[model samples]
Target: MRKLRIGIVGTGYVTDCHYKAFKQNRNAVISGMCHTYNLSHPKYREKQESLKKKCKGFDIKAYNDFNELVSDPSIDAIIISSTNSLHFEHIVAAINNGKHVLADMPVVTDIKQLAAIEKLSEEKGISIFPAHNFVYNEAMKKVKALIEDGRIGQIIHASFLSSHSISNNHLLGWNPNSELSKGEAMFDSGHHLIYQCLYLLGKPVKISSFKSKTILKSMDCEDTMQLSMQFVNGAMAVLMQSWSKDHSKMINGIRILGTYGSIVLTDALYFNDKKIMKMNDYMESFVRLSKAFSDNILKKVPPLSDLNAVHEILEITSNLYKTAEIESLRII
Candidate 1:
């Protein structure tokens, strides 16, 4: 069996998760790394060598130019962990090169870009997967199953709180730079919460949101956001995200209310005040997600969710931003 050769575009913190996930998969290999810019940086060189040493059994090539990596004959697919601003370009290049692509969340900041990628992907017959790791989560899966089994009855209301701690203006390396971050922590981490809502309640028809830079005033975009959405089925959801000085351990959780009862999730899934599933470590979901993506390419089966799933979330979030009267995000 020929293993899927994955060329990662960004050698950043998230790339380590992807590397670990790929290594766990016997059917995949990290064949290459591409630094979209400034490949001569000492950090880039150090990261390249470190990754190669980590994957000692496989031959890993590092490319300074993205085009070279995409055009490489040995590569099978691209896992884009690049900056949020670069997702559109990296995805387009890979699809145009006739390679499968799995990009990190908020695939593109604009809905128009997503439409272009959708059209191009259809024309090229390649899969462009937005790597929303939460849907692949063990606890999330258990919740989904219980809902499907009518254990939760019809979901009436849901709330998701996703938080990240950024003390003394110390957040993501890109958080302080609006050009690279595009929006703020919401634009990045919000994808997971928003997509999870869409996954559970489907698309929303009415949306309203309030956004503020509660903390990290130095950042160009909002550090906190609250979104309210109304689904066609009459279900309502409130999604909140923040990157502020909060306890790291108490940052994220979800609650869903249905006709029968409600379930609360933090480190485990609890149904009607009873624990149901233990949430596995975050890296495991990435492993399952990577394998599913490989199968989507190798077996030519349906992806984690169909292509429209990506577009709908993009459209919803785009609308949310517009409604909030937020400033136009920068695009690099």
Candidate 2:
């Protein structure tokens, strides 16, 4: 079969990551590009020029309009890597134009949007793959395999931890605004653990969560969060994320304890106190996902990350936030 002609919409950092990943895929070729960059920003012209130059160097067609990009008959799929607010609109346009979509995380803002997108996808015979890249990394794959093979036996408890800092400028978007950021943290930075828990331990039966502003007090959301879950299979998980103590010395990762052995996942995977496999770069996760997206399309198989998974994740996240509390803002 011929290569999948993937058209991309957006030129942000994630979009660049997707661009490079697709460039490495053997079964797909990036056919065109459309950007949602701010036309009023002072740097807009510079950014556009740079994006066009990059597209020209990569032999990808640059579309001035997103609609034209989606309507292009030669493009088989479109990636909705645009801003979070624009995701739904881009997704609808792509599906309407008979193009499959690979959307960034938090695929839709709410349950209603998700339902509508799902229905439209079904009606159009188009697929919308979620970009849950963290779980698609090499180490996570090994972690999943080990659990299936009983190397880790029955998981008893686990801890998933991550820490990274965000700048004030980055929060100038919707992140800091209470009206715009409600439940955003659950699927933005905290989304990985939710899906990873489901991927490893199955459905969670109970959930409790708390957050703290700490360093990001200017934002209405938390800079630190601790979420606890109890799975139907009797497994438990604690997910912790902090944006405060983001020094280079902070070693962030996942720790899983099982009946037989244990696993620790970071820049590597450790099984039974021994290092098993080194984790690939975070960007490599994007590469692996991009290749799978193309191969899945070519083979007529389901994507690694799909809307059903997103639905489950979103449901769990909703429950987590319902009872979440601000434990504290300033830590002594």
Candidate 3:
């Protein structure tokens, strides 16, 4: 069995997660990595050393130029863990180079870019799977199964609340200036809630949202967002996300209201209020999806989370942003 050689295009924190996930998969190998910053820098060096120690068996090379990593003939797949802004370029380059791509959330902020990628992917015959890790979570998957099985009956309404601590220090430490823009909180964190909503109840025909910057006054991007979606199935969803919380533990939870019963999974389904069953940890779902992706690549099976589904999620988020802007202007 030929190991799938993967070249990662970012050496930042989230790249560590991808590296660890790939390492756990026996069929995948981290062939090389690319970063704009010099790996010799103290911070970069520290990260490189840590990654080397963490990924013991993998042969990892750090490159200053992205093209060098993308053009590597040995790399069969690419993970675009670069800043949100660079995802389009990196993913397109990989597809042109005949490599499968796994990009992090919200591939692009604009619909036009997504459309271009969609067209090119079909032409190139390569797969571009957006890493919506939450979909793979065991608790969420069980909830999906229960809903489908009529255990929850008809889902009448749903709500999701996700809050994270985003102090100036936190933003500077994780997402540097170059990596994020004025409205990245919504684009970044909001995408998770939007995708989860879409995953639970297909795409919404209409979406309206309110996005604001409640904390870190200097930052241009929003630190909080409130979104309301009306699905074609007549099921409505309310999603709330914020970077203003000072809480230590952080919060990510969802509730689905149905005619028969209600299901709740907080912190990726690890905590459940119902006594019937326990929710699986979030990491377990990623492992399952990783194995599924590997099997699909080997056997020519369709991916569980295909590009079309991803495109829909992206489009819905884009619409939500537009709606947010309109609402903001009206309020002003």
Candidate 4:
């Protein structure tokens, strides 16, 4: 059996997460690293220098040009940790070059890009996996299993809250004002909650959302967002995201209310007078996700992070942004 030769694209903080996961999997090898932006840009230079320092112990080639990385025959697949705006272009390049892709979430901003990628991927005969890590979480896996087992009866409503402190958005290359940014807290952080809801429940038929910049006024995008979705299964999903400095990491979990009982996932999974402690570390989710992706590639099975799944996520997110934009104007 031949090992999969994978290249790391974008070399950001999330790149380290993928690298850690790749190192643990015996079936995958980190063949090379590629920074999507040119060295002329400070961000690119910083990332390249940081990548060099990070890759000291490892033996891997560095790619200055993305086309070169995509065209390399030795590379079988590429993991794209680039900015949200660059995903479509990188994915198109990889597909055209016949390289499999595993891209970070909010894969593409527009629904048209999603349509194009799906068509291109089918024509190219390759797989494009979206890095939706929450779906692969062990604790979430237990929650999914219980839901599938009908332990909670008919799911009535679900609420997901993801809160964190604001970071240096510029260093992270996240500018909601720039075309490069996918969106503010909703597209950046809220994608996780939306996808998790879709995974546990079903596709949402309608969406209502509100967004505001309550704290981080420097950025063009909102720092907080609230989204309400109505699923086809007659269930409701409420998703909230915040990057407020005032929040000292409050309830970051999912709560599903059903006819029979309820399930809540926080640091631990609790239901029916029982508690299942989560993994010691969250990195374990990336480990399992990487293994699953590699195994699917080797076995020619479908990846859980398929482009279609990402398309649905993007569709939901797009609607949320649209609604929020309209509501923000009304508020003003």
Candidate 5:
């Protein structure tokens, strides 16, 4: 079988992770990469030079523009790791050019753009795989299995805690910029835990949220978000996302309570408070997610979810964000 050729857009932190993940995949090869460099900014010169070195080391082609990358017949797919705001146009370009896409999360800034993306993919017979990497974690996969096997019986409540520390680089960059990132922590990196909850428990019917900037006050956006959800099954979930804290052990951890038993996870597998299995490094989740995307493209396995599932998550996320507008946010 011919290996899938991938072109990566936006050569940055998330792109670096995707590159490393694809390198470990036997079914795919990263043929090239390109970023729509902000030529107006003198700072991007350093970024372009860095990308040149990366391309040389990997022995892959680098396009000067996204159009060229998507137009290359040698590349079978493109990874859209660009800014949150640029995802829509990038994905559309790839799909129109017959290239499959693995787009990073908060895939698009707006919920209205999702249906058009779905329509384009269907018209082109291509896949627009969302980079919802946390759900691919072995521990998360195990949790889904346990819930289905009745190990914890019927779930009553789920709590997801994301206390990640943002870097000085990202804080000074597009992440905290409202017009660029289109959101704060909850809809950004925090999207990991949000999607994982939805993945394990299914979509929620009701969502209420509060956002505040307790830390990282240099930025205009909120650094902390608290979201409460009510599922149709009558189960409840509470998510607390904080860019203010730097707790590595507590990042993306969850606790689930069911009728018969409960589970608490903080970097290790625990069932009813008994440790069952140790987990792998967090980077492993990205690799596993890449493999899933590649295998699905190869028709060797079914996708974790289809385009509709992606839309559902985006819709719920949009609704959740709308519930807490900038005016309501407390900037303490």
Candidate 6:
């Protein structure tokens, strides 16, 4: 009945969501948090205080120095929720520190870093679980079962659209250099679509994509991205993600198409779709993943998103970015 001590690297908005989820898990404890940036910033400090207050029984220390958090002997696992660019270094340090890691999605923007982490995790005998929370969605899980059980026989073709407004300020906050933001949409939003695609159709053999900055004049990252994947199993998937869409009336969603039936999950895929599946909101997907990781740490079960699947998703994403870049050249 020992609690799993978890250290989180990053104190951003998404990290706060993670913190809240960790607090809800009775089997997990938020041991500490690290942020290399200005933790003294009012919003950042406020979030730290809020988390501390919320996780009253947990020992949550806020550190400006990430190394200090990584070096903490009390931390049994680390969650890498840092920015896309810093994921490689942070994850490496966590792995070397001999802690199980739950890395946020788009694990690393670069293929080299992704491969290195895969190798390092194997060498260290520590597990690295990517935060592809979609796979744990009750509806998606049901859909997966339906497909597997022949309720949806032979998944023919599928499409996914994840659109949201990435305000100018938000883009600037992440990448001061406009060009860098222009390049990260695929890494940011495309990762989710690709992960879902892999979950449904297995690994893709060839991926072709078109990415461009369609709007948001000040932002350099491509606000729009369209990817077409040809899975090794002969199933094809088309994925589109955009940051320029009008979010006032719009929301994110996915559709899985099969010969017998189709499944649709919208509005972050957890809340909206859970009701459709007649499930409770208490069943958060990250909580499931956290429990799964805890079980794996206790040697009770294997990691839910195994290394091979993680590698395949990372590879597909990296390749899609490359394809997008090539397509960009052809367009020019």
* Predicted structure with the largest TM-score when compared to the true one: 5
1-332: candidate 4 lDDT, tens digit per residue: 78899987776667878888888989998878887776677677777776666667466787776777889999999898787888889889999888988878777888899899889988988888878887887788888889999999998999999888755755255555656776878888788887788788878889999888887777678888999988777999899988775453447788899988899887778896478655436688889888888877887766655666677887887777788768344454
Q: In model 1, what are the clashing residue pairs, if there are any?
A: none
Mind giving the per-residue lDDT tens digits that candidate 5 earns over 1-332?
88899999987787778888889999998889887675665766777788789888878886766778889999999999888899999889899999998888877776678888888888889888878887777887888889889999888999998887889888878888888888888878777777778778888889888888998887777899888999998999999888987755745688999998988777688999999767767689889989999977887466565565667767766777778774664689
lDDT of 3 by residue, 147-202 (tens): 88888788889888888776555466545342454155666777778777777788
Model 5, position 106, has a per-residue lDDT of 73
User: What is the per-residue lDDT of model 2 for residues 132-172, given as tens digits with 9 covering 90 to 100?
Assistant: 88778878988989999998788899988888887665577
Judge candidate 6 at residue 209 and give its lDDT: 88
TM-scores of all candidate predictions against the true structure: 0.89, 0.89, 0.85, 0.92, 0.92, 0.82
Pairs of residues clashing in candidate 2: none
Q: What TM-score number comes out for model 2?
A: 0.89
lDDT of each: 0.80, 0.80, 0.73, 0.80, 0.83, 0.71
Tens digit of per-residue lDDT, candidate 6, span 1-332: 77998888766666766776777777888778766454556676665565556445345676646777888888899998876677788889989999888888767666677789888989998888778776776667766776778766777777878877766657657753533332566667667777777776777677898877777666655778888877666777888888777672344566666776666666433321334454324337767767666767776586545656767866776677677777344454
**TM-score for model 1?**
0.89
**lDDT of candidate 6 at residue 216, scale 0 to 100:** 64
Error of 6 at 65 (Å): 0.7
Shift in Å, residue 72, candidate 4: 1.6
Candidate 2: Cα lDDT at 221: 72
Winner on lDDT (2 vs 4): 4
Worst window of 10 by summed lDDT in candidate 5? 300-309
Per-structure clash totals for the candidates: 0, 0, 3, 0, 0, 5
Q: Which runs in model 4 stand beyond 4 Å of their true positions?
A: 39-47, 169-172, 246-250, 328-332
Candidate 1's C-alpha runs over 4 A off are 38-59, 166-172, 248-251, 326-332
TM-score of predicted structure 6: 0.82
